[model samples]
Target: MRIPLYALLLCSVPFMVHAQSETDSVHHSYTLSTVNYTIAGQRYQKNYTRSRELQQSTDRLLERIPGVTMIRRGNFAMEPTLRGLSAAQINMTIDGMQLFGACTDRMDPISSYVEPNNMERIQLGFSPNGEQHNASVGGGLNFSLKQAQTGAAKVWSGLAGAGYETNASATQTIAALQYSRSRFAISANGVWRRAGNYTAGKGQEINFSQYNKWNLGLSAVYLLKPNQQLRVDYLQDEGYNIGYPALTMDVSFAKAKIGSASYIYTPTGMKLKSWESKVYYNYIDHAMDDTKRPAWQVPIHMDMPGTSQTMGLYSRAKWYYTNHFLEAQFTAYSNRLHAEMTMYPKNAAEMFMLTLPDVQRTVYGIDLKDKIYLGQDWTLSPSLTVNYVQSDIYTELGKETLSSLFTGSLDRKNLIWNAGLNAEKHINGRWTLFGQLSRGARSASAQELYAFYLFNRMDNFDYIGNKDLKQETSVNASLGMSYHQHRLHIQPQLFVYRFSNYIVGQRKQGYSTMTIGASGVKQYVNIPDALLYGGELYATYRPWDKWYIQSTNSISIGQDNAGNALPLIPPFKSINRIEYTPSKYGFYAESISQSRQDRVSTAVYGERASAGFTIFNVGAGRNFAIGKNTLNVHAAVYNILDKQYYEHLDILKLYRPGRNLALNLSLTF
Candidate 1:
């Protein structure tokens, strides 16, 4: 693994001389084209998706990106983390649309509502480059949905596809159709997927790992005149019998509905280069129970129900000139969430408990970005954002517990802002160096603000929210260098952040008055100061004409944190691959390795330790053409070595899937 990785890195330096032009971009036609490898400002008109990638979940695909980690509670909706930050710290949206997960346990991530087949592309903006999402403190991940294209051909077009995997007995089906004419276009896509229990590397079956899901999307586009256009989109997704063995309960049913209308004006006039405005709304409902898994047991029978309603609006405008560009945006959004868990005595019919009620978070924000070119070798970019956030916990029925503790109806208001600057210099014809400095802030999540007597499995503790908690803030800086050549691209960067009023789970000293079965009670508390620092190296190369190799290694550490280490900090990890794709066919072999995660927070947070393991994977595929359609085929075996292991990121600490084979076939015109 090291040999191929080093070869791919060392032999391509000379080839990079011809690609010096990559350091500068006007159209930004090529963004991070690869699956999981991207840097700030990476922009591409057409994204690349490997054949094998189609068979993997969206969360798994995102793992390929450096500094990105996935917290795997189950097979779906893996929580994504970057640079030791996750959840609301990283703004996640679909084409500028906001969504909130209904599950307090985080069983359903926003990404779960979007299927891979419905995605046109994904762009993640890091610090100093996230003008698109000003509220983000760490980064922003944006999913661009497939839309009806204007000026389409007279004939109708459609595609159909199916896929399967063995480890979980999973199956996938997909279909899409589109029609376009002189001025209007319409498109629709549907997807269905189902899976059973997944087998581990040691042949053990993890309960609550099965799920069935489906989604449908409809879109319409009209060319108003010239470069002006209008578009509308609607999407709905449903999941049934989703299992979460790691959590206290399993999800029985969940559904999401989202709609958006946007107007885009990109006139050739050039003075007002572009203007975009959108209005979007999304809703989610989820229900969970322990009955989904017969083997699962708890002291008391419980039912969990959750729902969220969100409305948002955004508009952006860019003015361009010869050597300078300026842009500004306005955004406002509000989300209301009602999540409650009720416990029923197994023997007594009259006793039940109400947990978590009346939580809402609303935000309004604006941002600006400026880019200036210095001579022919330097570029300067700067951005700023400000937001007003409000949190409310209304106990109109007097049924909630936290309201009594806080003495009255809970209300909190905060005004926050973030600013960043990035500078880049082109060095001759082979190297480029960049630097970034930013100060960002994030408002507390709904749970952090007002959850009442919530049970947390990760630390085996009952959690209560803090109404007076301050918003978390961070000051960060990073430096990086990039080397580009004909056959290789290598980029390495190091970053550090100092957090103020960092919110963490602090173990309550006494348990006498705490909820039952609680090892300890945890309350949101402010740690005066904490620090997180990390770095990652990404490299890709083509040693020969037909062979390509890629590798990434990342590590991060947290200090002055709540535990021995930052909660869920990933260990030293690497993914190395060698592949050959000459024509319509391709073949590849890969190795994934990780170091032992001994820096556990168990002493402070009662988190458990995790052992490390390595896994081998391989795949091959080919495509064929018939009539007017093209058929693409792919097959792969995961965990070829069948090594027994589980990731530290799994909050439930469940064993990862072992050896499994998958096959995919699709056709398109």
Candidate 2:
């Protein structure tokens, strides 16, 4: 029998590991434990505090996680997928607030609204017991915002930074300032970025790849009492002249405004450990057009505009009992979305239609969880959530648009629930084992249930939604092991999911196309069953006091009940790195590799095979101290081999950026 790579590494190295339980106290600035695992209650944090990471985009920093992959349409905004699941299958949030994208083509994901400088850390929950905020089977990702800090030694502190990249001729400038006292704290930050067209491998300039954007954030906190505080936050982001070479149209502008307020209380020497209540609102606007394309390239010109607005609130409390920890939360939200398109044919009258129509959705949910201690070395956690959802077409034009396709009521409602159980056993001080089993279900999204004549650039097909589609559900199971010795740490995890009423877009034969020079139409449909399985392995070894080596590997497999490959599934990929660090300076070398994927879903998804490739990168950094202030400089060269390649998930098979040098400098006082 052939042994797996993870198993081989497990046998060859002695490891050390650590796990978190519900009883542990939460930190003000959450940081990942030394060992990062996919088990229940596992938290992972990137080194975003470093100067190198502070200069990168939010999307680029997210790609470093183990089970995450990015779907790129351009250099600007990229959508993220967790364990091969995208779109509505996963729940994404900012500071525990619900937000949705305005673009019908998914050019503006929620992550695009927050810059890296405004973020503190990211929290991920994969197990049903871990994620009780929403009805989702794939998992949940939450971006934590940076807040003002009180009781600091200095009355004021801030950082200023600038960066440049050769490949895209991109320039970036960022600034942050904070003021703190015994009872009050306030912070403000801003970022600006501009880029020209980028060059692909072999110095081929990729046209229509330029973009410009800016972001601003402000936060304030006031201490009402020794154990009580009030906080408020606001953020604004805007983008203009954004180009997408992979698609037929480019975005003229995209903008978002978000604001929130919260109250937090911590009780000492009581069963009620902590309580928090928060309310938030957000708005998004996006517009795109094909006027940038040449006359011959675009037989007809079209304009598309979309908007989304949301308001939400949540309250959570934690309590400690004898040998048990208990928690409960209540959440409610309302959202409205509208999208429309107008096409102008040469020497003909203008035609208009509702792409997404005017749709309204409201949701309310409650969650309860408990962690029981079964002695000193074992623990069990159980969680449950109940949610009520109501959806309707709120406009006469939307009702009229969908009336031609379906002969049913325009109102939809559903009650959904999710439950999960997890267990952990610690055999010794250095060895641990964990397992989880859970089931979850989610209602269809607005786009999936009521969209009309929505064109998909990936498959070159137009799509219509089905209002009568059934809810999708999944059953999940996972197991993991961790080991830690003196200088080595290793973790391996495996997971599998069985889905019911899986949703997909099926081709409708003999149907006319809506877009110019497009393929036939496709409609959303539910299949009987589908399966997804994946695994991840992480290892780090310290050969000497100043040198460290690390390896991360992940693989995913997806198939339908009929033994057909699923669309957009990524192949085996690995990242290896070596680093040497002394007190004030550091140097690193990294390699990223992916295996060739031959599995193609040509019939339904229009997928093609992709070849494997590898790339190398190197970087170094140094910090200089002058008085009480500090200055840092970092530089790196990426894609040193200049290989022409694209990942399996890259839509339209656009080649990634080629060799480039990046430099960043920052000063803190």
Return the top candidate by lDDT. 2
Error of 1 at 530 (Å): 0.8
Candidate 2 wrong stretches, greater than 4 Å? 1-49
Clashes of 2: 6
Per-model TM values vs. the true structure: 0.92, 0.94
Q: Give the total clashing residue pairs for model 1.
A: 9
Predicted model with the maximum TM-score:
2
The lDDT per prediction is 0.74, 0.80
Angstrom error of the Cα, residue 306, model 2: value is: 0.3
TM-score of 1: 0.92
lDDT of 1 at 302: 74
Which digits, one per residue and each the tens of the lDDT, describe model 2 over residues 50-159? Answer: 44455678877666667777888888898888778888888888888988999999999988998878877666676544542678877777777889998988999998
lDDT of 2 at 312: 87
